[model samples]
Target chain A: MTDDDLDLDLDLGPETPPVTPRARPTTREAPKSGVPSAKVMAERKPGVLSRVGSSVSGQLSHISRPNWSFRNFLIVLAVLVSLVVLAENWAAVRISFLGLRLELPKALAFLLNIILGGALTWFWLRRGVAAREE
Target chain B: MADPGGAWHRLLSLLQAISQRGLWATVPFALLVNSSITVLTLTIEPDGSAHRQISVVAAPYFRDQVPGWTRDVRADADWDMAWAVNREDDFVYNRDARIAALPESGEAAALTISDVAQNPFSLYTTYRWHEVVGYSYLYDSDPAAAEATNKSLIYEITMPGTVTNATVTPATGSSTKTEGPKVVFELAASQGQQTIEVEASRLRWGYLLVLAYLAAYVIYCSACTLRHWLRIQPRKI
Candidate 1:
């Protein structure tokens, strides 16, 4: 009642608990490969090709990592092939066989092959993933 | 149910792990099968009513070169005649008829048979021995069918042959005329060859196409199985 003069002794007849120190927010150390920060390099100067090369190499290294999946490779292959086919702009390309021939548009052929590849990939994934999951 | 995301990742992993040989094999295999399919559909004349469905036995009989037959056309080397008959009377009953010898000069090929079928319109008839081979008597029995334009009928194997170069005359009576034997028209090696020899053989073009596809599919299946087999082996590298 009087600034805890009388109550302090009454409430705490025993030892008082020590106050706990507040923890600091921890910061993570930068990775060793940091030659120069991207912002600093951009501000300093960056050649067009060098920038492109670095970006591309970064992607390539990422893809080449051991944990990369086969399905991703197939999808990339399909995409690249489809793009090339579309860019060629051929109409009704013909393939000949023993006294026979069929013509199909380039885009149609690429799309069809992609669909087939995707379906096969999906089937393979189902079996392997399901077993591993189990 | 556990996670589709995990399943897809596993699949991508499998695809990337496929061997280089497996990848290489797919290229040629696809090329072969796809090309063969294209050729087969594009070449063969679609089956039509004008197609003379003579039994293989009857086909030889009608050709008049049947060995030891009384009416052996081969033996009558000098015989050159032309005759026409109606469908119900001649073609239905008398399977064999004498056709004139092909003219020796002025043209390289002869017209043999011309039959027309219009539904998706296919005409499957042969030109043999210097004549166009078709349903010989149909023209007489079915005059209205004759007017049908697409009716399959063998009109005549012309005496003088037709000459076809790079320039083709479409719908022209004389330009695309089917000549006697294919030997006379193109493959000179076939000239003077016996009908039996030709009958026993297959078209080289068609045969080659089929074999290509067969080989491709076989390799593809083999490669597919081999990949699985190789996976079981202990890593050597």
Candidate 2:
């Protein structure tokens, strides 16, 4: 019933009449200021797709999605670059060491030098570990 | 909470790290234990027949006497580095006590099986893997070759013809060398023996016959084009 329709007068009332609350606060058990982080987490579950979607939507609010046809273009470009680099070093280079003639592609020679250096370093390190353990 | 397997896992991780970073440190005579792997060499014949020679430490690098894989299974002679193959599963030898410096020498063995049914010449490619009977991890069915991680598992395959492509699956620090028909794939034993897929083809009668048909077809097409170019339209039907 509306408050205006509840107008009544009692004739003989010994004690104080019943007192009714006019209005109650709608928010209960909640802090007076803002929502808590824990409550926000409890309200929803976070998934991988949801996180990605949220990130995308936040940044590209009005931008359109990228085309799908060029998805593998970067991989193809990387392969092409590798092939070009290999081709660039394909010219035969000669080196004379210890009265022996060694001829190989520039790439191969560099690779061999790197391998030899790595082997030497590994051997030295192994020796050091052995001695240290002993 | 304490886990029983955690200790074992930690020990294994330490050993693995040591093996990768430096020389082996489990045994006292780690340096004496030769850092050599069991080399398996397969010489594929022109007529689709194949032979594999597997050589282990202190074992005879089985001198292939017969064209069909004849071997002397004698471990008495100090095995020089060569291909040694033991086709049978019952092939087991006594481990040399001097190598490991252990009180008692355990048993050592090797077994190799090839899928010759998929002939390279017929299929244009073939897949083969070595099931080197392993130890150390005895509880598990040691189907793969179990050796020192620092050492290499070498597979030298002499194909029938020039090898077009040779790739090892599950690459773990693997390297391949292709010299004409011979393809040598060296992989870390830690990764286990990987399947070797080789694509090779020999110049045979079947290929020559197919090429002859292609050549005729090309010539006929070109000749027709030439006739049309000359405006010789007399022949109909």
TM-score of chain A of each: 0.30, 0.39
Instruction: List runs of model 2 lying over 4 Å from the truth.
Output: A1-134, B1-37, B57-149, B205-237
Sorted into a CAPRI-style docking class, model 1 comes out as: incorrect
| Candidate 1 chain A, poorest ten consecutive residues by summed lDDT | A36-45
Tens-place lDDT per residue, model 2, B80-105, is: 22333454432222211111111111
The 10-residue segment of model 2 chain A with minimum total lDDT is A36-45
Q: What lDDT does candidate 1 reach at residue B23?
A: 18
lDDT at residue B228 of model 2 (Cα atoms): 89
Cα lDDT tens digits, model 1, B127-188, are 22222111111112232333333222112212112222212212222123333422111111
How does candidate 2 score on lDDT?
0.46
For model 2 the local lDDT of residue B123 reads 28
List each candidate's DockQ score.
0.01, 0.00
lDDT per residue as tens, model 2, A1-134: 76545543233335685899753333335575766423323334578999999999898987776442333444544565555455544544546577565656666877788899999999999999999999
